[model samples]
Target: MHNEGKTKMIPFGDLSREYDDLSIEIDNTVAGLLKSGWFVLGKKVEEFEEVFADFIGKEVFAVGVGSGTEALHLALVASGVTHGDYVITVPNTAVPTVSAISFSGATPLFVDIDPDTYNIDTNKLRELVVIEKKRRGNKLKALIPVHLYGQSADMEPVLAIAREFNLTVIEDACQAHGAEYKGKRVGSFGDYACFSFYPSKNLGAYGDGGMITTKTPEQAHTLKMLRNYGQEKRYYHTIKGFNSRLDELQAAILLTKIKYLDTWNTRRRDIADFYNQNIKNKAITKPVEVSYGKHVFHLYVIRHPERDRLQAYLQNNDVQTVIHYPLSIHLQEAYKDLGYSQGDFPVAEKVAEEILSLPIFPQLRDKEAETVAELINSFS
Candidate 1:
């Protein structure tokens, strides 16, 4: 029995309509880039970096890079994470977080996430550092706390642990563009913070783009060199580096998107509130937003005991949903050599099985959200 008015399909994330919503503005921005005929790292990239640095605050310098992976890679390299160094991060994040560690000629040491926040478990991090020191003997050099699902990781303790252990803090803020921690931004708290401008990100560009925010001018300078073949001066090649420059076109597009980032993030928070207030199904657990910081809600994730069945039910009702990650990174085939097993990260493993990402974006209509909530409540 389909409802007559709410039958239209709702996508998990509709990038097409987003483009259509800002078609004219996006077209003009792209057109400007085409007319200028300057495509590489130029004025557009520089301007966006300046503006983005300002947005991050704390006088942090932002270095534009080719992608989020590259941003992490450069941040690690700049922080002196060389061959055989150990970098600690959560196993519940995107592969790129661990891959960047590998790319920096370092090994990734996995930590479990907090069940409530889905970010790095600070208590586990504190305990692990002590154990890891005994097992590996001071090889650990960094901690990359991912601000997962737009909520800040518990940074006070994480940073305190980092300070005590002498580890660099590289924030994986790819999903938390405007997220905060105790009235401060996530990127400002770390030694270096990496952001991804993937098409579906809270502050996405027209195409792939990324930025690394750093507090020190030296770190910023080092990142700039690393992203462009290690050359501060043309043909200088001071050190071996990658050709990972963020292009002008993407920068131009991001400049446009940055203008709307706060507004979009606010809308996302509003949608999350709607879902939180209305969805009363006991079988499903809604996402939690801690009071310590402002959550931007990049992906409105929920957990259900029968996640697969609920997803199927939503699909049948023409309301699309997705899983943020179905497999924990440590359990993935790519990291089988890391010597992890099924029960190693029990919390992350359990979350992977039950977590489902509901349709959430700035453009999601109130009626659509209501319809989705109604369908979810109707589930047996």
Candidate 2:
């Protein structure tokens, strides 16, 4: 019964409004592309890669890939992750984090998260490294610290342990476009940085897109070859690979969006600040950011003691919200066979029930934030 031209009853993240203007840019870019007639592995991708590499302060050697998942898989592969080797990571993360490890023919050794940042607990990671050294009889090989929810993990401790174990740190920076740790970008701090330009991310393409950034020229070359069927030249295969190229269309769309990434991320930070200042619900615990990083606020997740009741209240008020993850990876049907019981990762287990993501997209107006804050305060 809603009219055709009205705003949504309430938008979770109004991705459409952004596309109207962005569509024109994409169309023009595509037309130029069609006229040029070079589609795969062309100048557009190269240009964007250089720009993106510059953005992250790394050497210009990012291999554009199919999706965030593929970028992660390729990074692991480039880092020499193989069958029977285990990649240590947190279970309270996106499925792609674990899925990419599985895709790389490695087992993902699940770890618990820190209660505050929701990132892999660096202290817990150190403990596991010791356990792996003793029981597994070899190094764990790699550490993938996911910058979940647009905040960098505590990389100081994480990196220290990685050095001790000689582990390659592949940062999952998919949600953390323009996010920085100690004035250094997320993609530059780790051994290999992976970014996902999914449409909802802070820096989104029109569709699925991803990239891998490494400090070494050799690793970059390997990624470039691996994504394109393992060839330095056409019809001369060096090693087996996959069809994981980032299409020209996605690259172009991302290029345009990339221009506005910092601005949009700033807006997200502004909204998060607003949320932190205004909402005075005793049941709610706002996100805590470490001083070393500039959090991009991909999803402004808050924890509430009466979370279920708060969700219902928001629903009744025509405000749409969601849980970033309803179930921890350990409890998911996909990972149940890891032999993890409910009591295993108590922090992640408790967190899954408490975290709630409010609508905090950059385009959300000031009044919308004020309304969101007022409604939450009303719950008390």
Candidate 3:
């Protein structure tokens, strides 16, 4: 009888109400744009950029890039990652992390992740840097630490290590929105911070959009020029560039929703707490936020020994779940030349097999957490 109380279905992440939430402001913004007859790098994009830069607590020039991948690509270029140079990054993350390095003509050196944090292990990074410098001596350049699942990747240690070696740190803060550590936001810590405005991220755009937050005026100015065909003045190009500017429509839509980003992030936090407090299965290991961080809970992923079976169990009960990534980047068929085989990075491989992200969007109904918890409890 209690089973009848469940919602029709629980999507991994739903955005049905997203448009409805800001329809009024969005329609008004669109009408204004239409009346002005100005599109593509207009006032809306300019204003949104300033506001968003301020929001992330950085002096970002906020070049609206076409997508999250482009944000990383542009940031890497701006950071001076040269062709064939090595960039260190963890394997247990979205494919775009590796793709960005490849796009910049830099070779990605895949590293293992922390067993608990699911983030690139900074201590392991020290070893990699030392060995690479000893072996190749001056071939290594930068580090890309992904803040997976809205938790800062233990940035304190990562930052220390990066500074010690004078390597550029470009944070893949794509999944982390409003996440903080030691009372400071994620984007503010690194040399360059990149974000994805894909509709599923914690701070998502209506469609594909992205931004880079940087402190240096030189870096910011170069990023803007890079996005606009490397032209500082009209019809004049200083250097060759690509067409990857963020669209005006996405900017207007994102600006409307930016006002409520904090509240929604708080809601996500509450739902995560609900799950952590309620879901008690000895076979499952819930996500752990370090003592000094404010995790935004973009995904409430749990580690399960019987991960495949647990996913099937949730599906049979009409609850939806997804594997954030079922394969580590180095082990993929496309990266065969990286030559990483099984047992090369045991930690990342283990996470690939066991980690499962549950339904934990901000707009999730109040009862869904309890019900999901109850279902998990009964999962044996």
Arrange candidates, best lDDT first: 1, 2, 3
Clashing pairs in 2: none
lDDT of each: 0.92, 0.87, 0.86
TM-scores for candidates 1 onward, in order = 0.97, 0.96, 0.96
Encode model 1's per-residue lDDT on 230-314: one tens digit a residue.
Answer: 9989999987788899999999999987999999999999999999999998898998889899999999999998999999999
**Which candidate should be chosen as best, given lDDT against the real structure?**
1
Please list all clashing residue pairs in model 1, or write none if there are none: none
Worst 10 residues of 3 by lDDT: 55-64
Q: How many clashes would you count in candidate 3?
A: 1
| Runs in model 2 lying further than 4 Å from the true structure | 3-8, 58-60
Q: In model 3, what are the clashing residue pairs, if there are any? A: 64-246
Better of 1 and 3 by lDDT: 1
Alpha carbon lDDT of residue 164, candidate 3? 80
